[model samples]
Target: MGSKLSYYMKILLGIIMSILLYGVVVYAQSDALGHEKWEYVLEDSGDILQIAIPVSAGLITLLKEDYKGTKSLALSYGTTLALSYTFKHITKLKRPEGRNRFDSFPSAHTSSAFSGASFLQRRYGWNYGWPAYLLATIVAVSRTEGPDGYHTVWDVLGGAAMGIGSTYLFTKPYENPKLEFGLSVNRSSRILTIRYIL
Candidate 1:
């Protein structure tokens, strides 16, 4: 039941991601809601996703009682942030809007979002990763979108690479303990068995 439920949830996330992708394609074609309003919506959604993705990944591990996974997630995410900020300090690049003095080399929001996406994929599978990657891509685009967009293409790409690299450093694949049925026959007897892992 647990494995089944997890697979179902992954499917749902994939569905939701498809809808979001469709929305982006559709909305980009029309300015019916005006640029400011739609741009704000994208910006706000990106802000939420930057944190929400990693938090959601953590919750999944916690629900499965995977303390090791939780610890690894923290380590990976912390490293991503540390690396991102370190680059920010070292490069001291200005934002597209020139709003900040020097904190725009690698988009932290993109990094955070990608950390979750890559962690889930690397630790679980593509069934969990594909949708996450799509959502993270949206976060990256949002950072470079709108009249007040913050980062550049290079910034988002660098952030994405940083986040993924960190997760790969610490995360491991998770084996699903799905219930399976088996039949065995011996010289004296035949038997049916059910198997699963805790």
Candidate 2:
């Protein structure tokens, strides 16, 4: 019964965080474009990073015989991609450059990178999360540099929220165990650890 309660609490907390993150994303949209003058840089490198890194990571994890880790990574990446594409289509907000008539409400590349980062954090530790997030940040910046205004700051935030939220919601048990819990993120070491009373 305690485990069940813990599960519920974890889910509840995740929900709350999702809501707050969403709120922040919504609030950030107003000034996203005002901060900088737009420029164009077609650094198609994002595609390579997006596909190659995750696949290689996932493959490495699998090679190491970590099925759970592989599954978790796959799920996070797949869900983020689905969410990003769906959101783009649904919102149809249009990029700043007007090249694509899609919604600029959320950034797919950022979300993908975030999902990858979130998965690494959950399985490996914070040591991986920081670099992943830093890479995600670069991906977000790249979008802005492309003159497409393809994304606003809010969009990047939203992408991050989706990336992390989806993982939290899906990876956690439907019900939790009862007891004390702890969470940690190692910025430099790229490690994440969660300890709970069983």
Candidate 3:
């Protein structure tokens, strides 16, 4: 119980720190075009990439017969999406330059992307995880790039916090029963046999 409590406390602390860090970044920089310089062929593909993470995870889970992983991913993704939209509506914050007046407090793309990345990392390990994280970072950065930027740094930070927090809250380690192996020898017939139990 104490460990669980500590885990949640750490997640909360992380969220608070991220928000504070975002505040510092906002205060330290006066330039509104900080992220505008990054323009490339993949810039417009952020949304597609973000959505692909979960879809790919789901497909892989299904193919690999990972029912628990699939369920955990679904729960985490759904909860993150719900929380993000709820905050967006409640805050009613406008996008940069008043492009959109509602649903702008949290960047949904960043949240979703991060949620998928977190899920992959938590379940699979670093090999599959690091690339997902890198992609998620790209999605977050893309949200704030160019003259038509949709989200501010604060919004992206909030989304990231929500994504990481949600995944940590919902996903659990999967445990599989260990296989038992044994060897038996019969003296009468001098026969050897191997036994395996699942």
Candidate 4:
């Protein structure tokens, strides 16, 4: 029960932080456009790295045969995508410039990347989480660079916050009945028994 409560509390915190971040980004958008470097190499590298999130998740799930983890990741991904697109339409903010100038409030790539990273962190541990997050950050930075300059820093930040928040809200704790285990001992008889719930 305590663990469940803690989990919900964390989700709530993520939601609050996302909302706060949205407000901050809206206010900071005016000053967020001049930081782009127009480096094609970095942008291309980030685009490639962005694919690692889903690939890594899939590899981990397959290697460990963790169906529950896969399901959690799917839920996180769906939720993040849905929310990101919904907000983009609702906000109706324009992109930095160029042909794709509309629906640029929240970057879908950044959100997807962050959602995958957040799911890995919440479901697994920081060992996998931190690296995933770093890659996600690179993806976000990539969105702000390049000739097109797809999004502003504010957009990337908002997307990241939303992605993390959505993942936290949607991904539930893993529960595998077949994997349950218990140990018991009979002191008087000097007997020890290990039990598998399945």
Candidate 5:
């Protein structure tokens, strides 16, 4: 019962955090956007996704009792962030907003989103991959589109490549545990095999 309660609390906390993050994103940009409703919505979605995609991926692993997958996600995500920031500092490309700050070689939001999406797809299957990929793609566009765009097309592309590349390095396909026995006969020889998949 205690374990179950803790599980529920974790999920609840994740939901709360995601909501707060979304609210902060929308409110933070509301004053500066001055754009159409659709643009605002698009920007809001993308901003929220930076946190949402990874949180959802992490939660899914926990929900499915995939401790190994959780570990893989941590490594993949950490590597993606490290690489993105490393490139940003190395390139020092100017942002689209012309804020005079130059650390926008890669879009963090886009990289994180793609990392999460790739993690889900590679660890699980296409059933989860397609939707995550779709959301990640939106995130990539969000960095490039809108009046207050933060990155150029090259930055978004670089971020996406980093994300996919890092995730592919750490994540593996998830498989269910199975035990089976098989018998084979090859003319004069007979073989029995026991297989356990973990």
Candidate 6:
């Protein structure tokens, strides 16, 4: 039952991502929210998110018995970062109320937080996932908390969707395939085999 529920959640997250991606594309062309949020997102004042995301990822990786959890987290976070940066350049959307507001297509902070938190949540369950997600939410809120011309709410939303969805697709815990390792020990003229699955 638990596994089935998790699978459904993953599917729901994917659908949400698809909707958000489409929405971002359509909204980018309009000036409904202005570009002030973009400026906030780009502000380079030592992003707490940068520090927090990796830490969260590390915790999830460490707490889980399966090394594959670590690998999955790494892949999810890495892909999200790369994609976020690419979108930033490709979209060329500028920050809110900034000269280059049209250049701000994706929110990096949002992407980073979402990716890390999503991985943690799926890998370690609510106990670890809750804090990670809370921090990620803070990162999202920070975009609109100050005068930094980084991103708009819509941009953050789009980024969040991307991060969560990407991780959900790639690192889903319940659906993860099993991996087995074999070890052999020879002692006292006896042969023993040890096998573990992750």
Native RMSD of candidate 1 (Å): 4.4
| Positional deviation of residue 98's Cα in model 4 after best superposition, in angstroms | 4.5
Residue pairs that clash (backbone atoms under 3 angstroms), model 5: none
Residue 186's lDDT in candidate 1: 91
Each model's lDDT? 0.85, 0.60, 0.72, 0.70, 0.82, 0.65
Flag regions of model 6 displaced more than 4 Å: 1-46, 63-65, 99-102, 174-198
TM-scores of the candidates in the order shown? 0.78, 0.60, 0.70, 0.70, 0.76, 0.61
Candidate 3, residues 1-198, lDDT tens digits: the string is: 323433443454355345445544554543465532224323455766679767766765675577988999999999999999999989998888566477677999999989988887787655556667776887788788733678999999999889889989988754444565555557655544555542
Alpha-carbon deviation at 29 in model 3, angstroms: 26
TM-score of 2: 0.60
Q: Choose 2 or 4, whichever is better by lDDT.
A: 4
lDDT of 2 by residue, 62-154 (tens): 655667667777777788888888988888777776675667868887787677666655655554445555555656666665434567788
Give residue 111's error in model 4 in angstroms.
Answer: 0.5
Alpha-carbon deviation at 18 in model 1, angstroms: 9.3
lDDT, candidate 1, 1-198, per-residue tens? 446645865775766566566656665653554464556667877888899889988988888777888999999999999999999999999888768567898999999999999998898788678778878998998899854789999999999999999999999898766788999999999999998875
lDDT of 6 by residue, 169-188 (tens): 77865334455555556665
lDDT of 1 at 87: 99
Tell me the tens digit of each residue's lDDT in model 4 across 14-102: 55345434544654333255433334544665576556676666566665577877887787778888988999989988888666567
Clashing pairs in 1: none
Best by TM-score: 1
Candidates sorted on lDDT, descending: 1, 5, 3, 4, 6, 2
Candidate 6 Cα lDDT to native: 0.65
